[model samples]
Target: MAQLMTIARPYAEAVFALSQEANSLAAWSEELANLATISQDPAMAAMIKNPAYSADQIVSVFTEVMGENLTKEGKGLLSAMAGNKRLSALSDVSEVFETLKAEAEKRVRATVISARKTTVEQKKKLSAALNAKFDAEVEITYEEDASLVGGIKIKVGDWAIDGSAQSQLNKLGAAIAQ
Candidate 1:
């Protein structure tokens, strides 16, 4: 997984630079998402790996499947990936592109896992707090996990704040056992 991400990073960065210059970040985002979806399909995966299909043929099939949704730049990306036999990296490329897009837009995605569903007021407050903490706009997604027992666990990017009753108990247990 890490190696694939490393391999995909350059492609994602190149696309990001191009999109920035073209002022088509959103369009490129959608295009990368669609390409990743198509490339990750099990049938498409098999076809991509098969030696029977030439690179041009695979690109044609991909472009045909995309229909009018594909742009000229999208076709170029597909052709390059096909030529390089890097179609399998599409998922990672999409992920990296989204990360870059989020950073560029000054937005962060946060997940709040709680024992129960959060109220609208709670969500709003949490969102505000996260925005202040990150100095960026926060997009919150709430999830329920009864195993948390109480409180909430907030995850944003590489950081996590674990404030659940289960976590406290585990910490207490470890301290006592030591």
Candidate 2:
């Protein structure tokens, strides 16, 4: 995983820089996301990994699948990846690019898992709190897990706050066992 990121870093940084220069961050984001999706498809992965297909063939398949949605710059990226045999790194490149974009845009994505659906008011309050904490705009998504028993678990990037009853109970159980 780390090696993949390391291999993908230069590609991602180059794309990010190009997008910044062109003032097309959103467009590049969409392009990279689409390319990543296509490259990550099981069938496509098989094709990309197989030695039977030439670089031109791989580029042709990607170009056809992407159709008119792909921009000229995106096509160039595909050609470069194909030539470098780095098509498999598209997913990592997309992830790293998104991280760069989010940092530049001063935005953070958060996920909240709760025992039940959260009310709109609760979500708004949580968003506000996260915004205040991160000093950036917060985009939150919510999921419900009944096994949580109660309370909530919030994850923002590498940081996680697990306040779920199930988590607390597990910790208590471990302590008691010790």
Candidate 3:
């Protein structure tokens, strides 16, 4: 996984730089997401990994499938990846690209898991708090997980706040056992 990320980093950085220069970060983001999905498809993965298919053949298929949705630069990127046998790294590249985009835009993505559905006001307050904490614009996704029992858990990148009742109970159990 680490090696895959390492392999994808340069491609993602280059693409991000290109997008910045072209003032098309959003377009590139959408395109990379779509490309990552297409590349991860079982059929596409098989074709990409098969020695029987040439780089041109793989790019041809990609172009045909993506059609008008793909920009010239996108096509060029596909060709480059196909030539280099890096098609499988599209998913990692897309992930890294999104991280880079978020940083460039001074935004952070977060996920909130709660014991039940949360009110709009709750979400708003959470978003504001996260924004203040991260010192960046916050984009949040919410989920309801009954297993949480109560309270909520918030995750932003590698940092997480496990305020869920289930987590507290588990910690208490561990301490009692010790």
Candidate 4:
């Protein structure tokens, strides 16, 4: 909820600041992702909610479970969040941080689906073309769907370029009917 964002904003900001200072933005991203993933486990959720557990105990458990993924700063962050009873918001902070990171890097994550896998050369050319078109780095993820029949459909942000065989067939069918 929007109200949760309000509560989580300060925690996100604090983590962002720490990440910047340590020159560990990428590292923090990995650690936060790990934390968020683990927190999603029902068992972990219950442990975090159990009132009998001390904040330090929860922080220790998170650290031990997090393994080497938690750097010193990340561990400190976990402790702080546990102490403040804000661990539930770690996922929100991680999601917001990823958005901020993407914006800062001027990168867009794109999904490209085609009838089959694209060749390395085709991927290179497409990425180069997209980078030139967007004036930013493009991370292209591909999916294969025989249902596409042929051609490729690209979803970039709000825009989609539908160049699939199915679409062409529909257009041809409409023209024949008219």
Candidate 5:
């Protein structure tokens, strides 16, 4: 996964630069998402991996499947990746692009899981706190997981705040056993 991400970083950065220059970040985001989805499809994966199929064949099939959805630049990206046999990196590229977009827009995505559904007031307060903590606009998604027992866990990117009762108990158990 890390290697794929590393391979994708350059492509994502180049695409992001192009998108910024063209003022088509949102459009490219959508196109990249579609391309990623298409690339991940089992049939498409098989075709891409099959040595019997040439790069041109793969590009033609992908273009046909995307139909009129792809802009000229989108087609160009497809051709470049296909020519380089790096189509499998599309998903990582999309993820990296989204991360870049979010940072550029000063926004962050977080998921909050609690033992019960959060009240509107609680959600608003948490969102505000997250925004203040990150110094960016927070886009929060709330989920209820009874297994958490109580409190909540907040996940933002690679970081997680585990404040649930279950987590506390596990920590206490480990400490006592030690």
Candidate 6:
């Protein structure tokens, strides 16, 4: 995972800079996402790893599968990625690029899991809390997990706050056993 991030960083930065320059962030974002999905397919992976298939073959298959309606610039980017043998990293690049773009737009995603269905007010308050904590524009998604029993679990990026009753019970159980 670390190596994938390392390999994807430069590509993400370069694409982001180009998007800023061209003011076509949306187009590029969609194109990269589609390309990433294509590159991640098992058949594509086999093709990329197979010594029998040439780079041109890979590119040809990608172009054909991607259809004929793509912009010339998008095709050019795909060709460049294929030529450089970076197709396998396309998904990683796309993911990191989306994160970069979201950061640029002052948007963050937060996952909130609660014991039961939450009201609109609850979601709004949670979003407000997360926005206040991170000082960023937050988009919160809510989920109901009955196993949690009570309280909530909030995750933002790599950070998680597990205040779920089940979690505390498990911890207490471990402590008692020890």
TM-score of each: 0.93, 0.86, 0.88, 0.66, 0.92, 0.84
Tens-digit per-residue lDDT, 115-163, candidate 4: 9989999899889988888788999999999998999999887778989
lDDT of 6 at 35: 84
For model 2 the TM-score comes to: 0.86
lDDT scores for all predictions? Answer: 0.93, 0.95, 0.95, 0.84, 0.93, 0.86
| Minimal lDDT window, size 10, model 1 | 73-82
- How many backbone clashes can be found in candidate 6? 0
Give me the runs in candidate 3 sitting further than 4 Å from their true place. Answer: 1-3
Candidate 2 regions exceeding 4 Å error are 1-3, 41-43, 67-69
TM-score of 1: 0.93
Better structure of 3 and 6 per TM-score = 3
Model 2: per-residue Cα lDDT over 76-113, one tens digit each: 98899889999999999999999999989999999999
Residue 115 accuracy (lDDT) in model 6: 98
**Ten contiguous residues minimizing lDDT sum, candidate 4:** 1-10
Candidate 6's C-alpha lDDT? 0.86
Q: Tens digit of lDDT per residue, candidate 1, span 123-151?
A: 88998899999999989889999999999
The candidate that achieves the highest TM-score relative to the unseen native structure: 1
Ranking by TM-score: 1, 5, 3, 2, 6, 4
For candidate 6, lDDT tens digit of each residue in 59-111? 88878887865667767766777777777888898899999898899899889
Judged by lDDT against the true structure, how good is candidate 5?
A: 0.93
Better-scoring candidate (lDDT), 1 or 6: 1
| Residue pairs in collision within model 2 | none
Off-target runs (Cα >4 Å) in candidate 6 are 67-73, 174-178
